[model samples]
Structures are given as structure tokens and as C-alpha cells.
Target: MKHCRTRLLTACLGLSALTAPAFAQQACAPRYPPPTTIAAMFDMAAVTADTLDALPDVDVVLAARGGQDLSKYGLRHSHLAFLVRNDQGSWDVVHLLNRCKTDHSDLYREGLVNLVGESSITTDLRVGVPTPAVRGALKALLAGAAPQARALHEPRYSMLAYPGSTEYQNSNQWILEVTAAAMAQSGDGTVLDDRKRTLDWLKQRGYTPSRMHIGIGKRLGARFFADNVAVTDHPASERISGNYSVVTVESVFDFLHRSGALERELSIPHQTPVPAVTGTASPRQASSP
Candidate 1:
């Protein structure tokens, strides 16, 4: 894995944090200041991008950020996306985002800085290096295969969407399905192009969704107040226990690592009090990944 040293600036700006689309599905309320400043967020993204740029012959990598702190639920990072290198020698983040206060979502292509600054609750950037074959497939699908990538997106958004169901999809679920679509190849060189086929391929490959323990009070609250969260797509047995299975950053990375699809993992930490110098800051391997 490659590493880079980046400086974090402490310039104070009254920059408001953007509302998280699906990662942080809390009750409707007033927004609060993010944990890190905009300058630190940009610096964290720069560190990540520079690390990728330092790698030899790398094109696509899995990047994730921490949005809402779900430590109570045993979760850290909230959302994940693919960072694909473009011809201009820069990276673009491709992921799914729910429309503002709506139950539908759309695919978005933005910069790494925008992704890191989206209501991030932590300063660390988590990245996964996929196997060479998987990286090649993802790079091809995300960079040049626009129509093929669009076909995997399902507009209906649900924070607790089931991995096996097609009724609704969460943000991480779309990335998982697209990953399956990229890896599901045939002898004749055909790949899974639709959600159903990709989902089936995921199941066949033994992909598992993370089970979140949402208590009765929170479940009932989200039932009535949360527009972007839904549990109807989950099976009755799981929903009755107040623990719904949903796709998450940890689950997706675990699947990739256990299935031998990932080659290495790296963690880029950011601290506001650190000196603003381009000194050597080596990223460590994540214990969980």
C-alpha cells in the first residue's frame, strides 16, 4: 500500500455541513457543526488522493468516510464509494446519494473533497485496494461504461434496505451490486447488467449484509418521521426483532477481504492539532479490514 504526508490547515470558515443522504439516518432536527473543519476535511481527502497517486499503476480504489457516529451500533464508517482515476490525472468519486429529504436516490459523480466534507463525523479516510482483476473491472465500469453503470441504480431509497430485495436500495447496497456486476462474468464475456442479476450474483458469492440493532423506540420513530428510511423491504422475521440487515461499509469491505477480492487496506488519519507540514505520515493497515 502507498502512503503520503499532507498538511492540515486550521483556517476557520463558517462552512455549513451538507446533510448526509442515507448514511446518517437520524430524526429530523437542526444540523450541527461537523467534527472536523472544512480545511481539515480537504486535507484528509488530499492525503488519500496523494496516497493513491503514489501507488504504481493504480486506477480504482474503495474509499469510505465516517458520517454519523454509530458506535452504539458497533459501526464506525457510514458510507463507501469508488474513487476512479480520470485521464486528467485526478480522481472522481462515484456513489449513490438520496435526494434531499426524499425517498429516492440517484447516482452522483463528484470530487474526493466533496465526499470527505459531506457531514463527516471523523477525520480518518478508509481505503481498500482491490485485487488487480477487480480493480480493472471497476475502473472500466466506472470510467468508460456510463450506460452500464447507470443500469445498476435503483431510485427507491431505504436506509434499512435488504440486500436480497429489489424493492428499495441504500447507498452502500448500490456499490455492492455494482461490484457484483463487475465480477459476474461468463465464459462468453457477458456481465451482470441489472440489479436482479447482480444481487443474485452477490448472494451466490456469499455476501452478507450487516445487521443493525435498532431498538423499538428508534424503529417506531423512523417509521413515522424518517422519509429516507424504510423497513418494509426487510424480511418479516428480521424486522420483528428490531434488528434489520443492511449494507454497510464494514460489511462490504469484510466481504471483499474474506472473498479474496481485496489486496490491501489502508487508513489515513487526520488531526487538527498536528503541524501543517508535508512530513512523512505513513498510513497503517486497518485491523478490522
Candidate 2:
């Protein structure tokens, strides 16, 4: 009779378990506060894509150094899809997302090419003198010989060309040639005169000249002076015939100074006059000699 009672109790318990509601099998409730606008959604997606692109490109295994999972650094299909859409829509990528995951070296190379291309297009559109106002100001300083300053306005055509890997020795010669041609028609005696003066200035600044080939035109025939230590010009081109010159930092600054392209200082701190004092100071006695 006790065994029967026990069996009856077990059966009741099993029945209760079987009849209990299956809360875990129920569907999840929807989350609230959905994204408000299409533009906002696009912005969020673009930002995510940019974040993915900014990840460091170093081999994940090497970067992780045997601790973190390298797989985490590898580009995901989802990330690629996001990047494709962002690139299609955005004009300029402002924010880079993940610095750790992006392949930085490749990105740097690609960025250099794009910037050069855009700059070339913009520079080619502007005609006439490079800096007319500066030229006029210099002419005024020299007293009414402004028309003769036309020599300063001579056209110097610049092409973006790619230099061959072995063309490092040819850059300076090309720059000399172009400068010669550009200054030739200026009635500036000889191109070497200006070149010599420019070279002397550069030397005084502690720059040692080296013969280097910079691919800057339709053909990789342009040459310029480059010091390996003091100057670096990275050459990039889609085709050998379309190579561009990445002007050295020193060269650009020197050019701006020589051509008066540098900006003038505004009023100096002490130069501004104080308002004239209207009220008089206490008068001294006339008897005091």
C-alpha cells in the first residue's frame, strides 16, 4: 500500500511538470525606440564602416603576439559591406573608426594618390600668375616697373607622373630643366642664375642637395634636388606616364617664401595705437622752471 502511494505521488508530480507553461519557448518581445530617420541610420552605418577601415592593417597574429585572438582583427564581410555603402555615399571620410583593425599602410598609400589627383585637378584649372597680388606689391616696392614683373608670371606647367623604381637619380635634373624653361622667357638672364641663388639659399639652411628623380609629369623625365635625410618625395602613379611629384616639405616652404606666396603678418601686438587721451593731466605750476 505504501509503494502504491509513492507511485501515485510520482505520477502526480510528473503530470504537474508536463502541464507547466513553457515560458522559455515564447518569442522575445520587440525592443522600443526605433531609429527615427533614414539619414540618421545612414550616418550610423557610415560611421561604423569608417571605424572598421581605421583598424591597423598589421597581420593580426603578429599584432596580437600570441595573446589576443587574431581572428578579431580580420576584416568581416559585414564590415566590407558597410564600407562599400559608405564609400558610395560619402564625399570625404572624416572619422576613422577602429585604429587597431585597419590596414594603415595600404590606406596611407591610397590616400596619398587620391590627394595628389585632387590637388592636380584644382591647380590645373587656375590660369595666369600664381600670385598676382604679391607680384604687384613687389613691383610697387621696385618703383613702377610692374609690367616688367610679367617675367614672374611665366607659366610653369606641372604634371603628376610616376617615377620608375630605379629613377631615384633623375629628379633634380628634371626640376632644373623645368625651372630653366619656366625662367628662360622671363628675361632673367639665365635659368642657372635663379637656380644658383635658390640652391645657395637652400644650402644656407643646412640642406645637402642630392640628385633624385621625381616622377612629376606625363613622362618620368622630371628631375629635382632632394636630400634623402632632409627631404622625401613619395612618387605614386596609376601608370608610368601619369606619375606625380609629392613635393618635399622644405621645397614647398622655400617656394612660398621665394614667390612671396607666404602670408604677411597682421598688425603687430604693440603697433596698434591707443586711443588719444582727451582729458588733460593736472597742470604744473608755471613758476616751476
Candidate 3:
């Protein structure tokens, strides 16, 4: 009887922790700060980009990082960016990021490693390679991506944003929409341009965002405390039904491949295992430890 009672109590405690409102996140709100000037995250991002560049004859590739181990919730790779060397021979990684650790909410483009900054829980990453067609479009759009990102970018940042809405955008969500512009195919079998048109096309073609199970407590607290976090973007039905859907790297990759966009993928250590979906995506594409 005592053992059974103890088990029940433990179960209750676990449930409470999971369901508990972000008392911890609010009271002890984990201060997500930027990396120090002397930090190595900056250099690491460059090194990672160079290493991806080393892939035999692969000049540009889509790189992603989870920063935190959300494997228990199925989001191992949470953020993404395009790594390339421009005509000026300088390596540039164009990506979107929430201007968090600040008073206001906005998006900014910084160094490659700055994406992870001091937020990364680990040093590993998972990389995705576009197909020739996708890559061609990706390369062509590089020059215009900055402005495109700026246009699609909403200063309101939310990790649990509605995938279909432009109200609030996250790091990976912006990339997904921008990439959709490059990879979207229309009814007449022609690729589309313009962010609004491509996103509309994505909706028509059954593109779905990944559902996050962050529970109601964190959702409420996040919105209450963080200016960048918004919970209303998700559908009222989904929120009432307890389904927290947010755009993520996994969803982006899944959607891209489902639409015949992503050509290859590479997963690395110190993170969740890669997807088993068929394609050129490998568990490890000859990456070093």
C-alpha cells in the first residue's frame, strides 16, 4: 500500500511539473543571454560553415542547430541558416534571429555562430542539402534573401507561433517561408515568386507545421513575460484542443522533402537522432566527431 501510494505521489509530482505554469520560467526565467565578446561561439559557427563547405564540391548548404536538447519533445534541430561564399570570396551565413536579450522584439542578421549564440545547449548540428533544382533557386535568390527576410520578418517573435500566420516569426519559421518562395511549385507546374504567393501556395498544397507540446502553462507565461512571445497566433481550436503547433527545422525539412524540395540531409552527434524518411538524407554525411 505504501509503495503504491508513493508511486502515485511521484506520478502526481511529475505531472504537476510538466503542467505547472511557468513559475520557474517566470520567477527564475532562464536568462537567455548573448555570447561574450571573448566567446568561441562566433568562431565555431565559422568553423562549422567551413566544414560544411568541405563537403566535396558543395559550395552552399542549409545548416541547422537545435542549441537546446528538446529531443524529449521531438525538436532536436530547432534553427536553420544558409551558409555560402559570395562573389566577394567572403563566407556569409544569411539567417533570421529574434533580437531577444533586449527590450524590444525584432529580427536581425548576424554572424553564423551568433544564431546559436549563448543559447545552444550543445555544440552539434544537423545540416540539410538542397537538390540541384532547389539549390539553383536558392543560389539565385541569395542576393534578394536579405530583403525577402526583412519583408517576411515580423518583429514579434514566438517559439510557438502559428505556422500560417505572419503575426509573429521565429528563427526557423522565417527561413522556412523564404525557402518556400524558392521551392514552391504551382498548379501549372511552375515555381512561384513573392512571399505571399508562395506561402499561399504552401497552404493549398497541404504544408503542415510541427506541433509543439509545450503545455498551457509555458504558453501563458511566455506571452505574459516576454514581449517577443505570442500565443494567439495558433488557432483557437488548436489551443483549446491542447495542440501547440510551431514551425521548426524538422517540420521545414519534412515539408520540403514532402514537396520534393530537400535533396540531402546530414545529422550529427550530441543531439537527437535523425529522421528515417527516405531520400538522400543520411544519418551522417561523412562528418567528423
Top candidate when judged by lDDT against the true structure:
1
- What C-alpha lDDT, on a 0 to 100 scale, does residue 281 get in candidate 3? 42
Best by TM-score: 1
lDDT of 3 by residue, 205-261 (tens): 778887767677776777578676667877888878767777777888888778777
Expressed as tens digits, the lDDT of each residue in 1-289 for candidate 2 is: 5334433433332223223221112122322222232222233223322332343331000000011122332311111000111122221211111122221101110111111121221121111121334333332322222233222221221222112221221222233222322333332433332334434433443332222232344132333331221112233233333323332222333444464443421110111123444765455754456
Model 1 Cα lDDT, one tens digit per residue, 86-162: 67666767888775658988776666665777433354778898888888888877765477777888889998888
| Each model's Cα RMSD | 10.1, 32.3, 16.8
Cα lDDT for residue 157, candidate 3: 67
Sort by TM-score, top down from the best: 1, 3, 2
Number of the candidate with higher lDDT, 1 or 2: 1
Give the clashing residue pairs of candidate 3, or none: 67-121
lDDT of 3 at 214: 66
TM-score of 2: 0.18
Worst 10 residues of 1 by lDDT: 8-17
Clashes of 1: 0
- Per-model TM-score, in order, reads 0.80, 0.18, 0.68
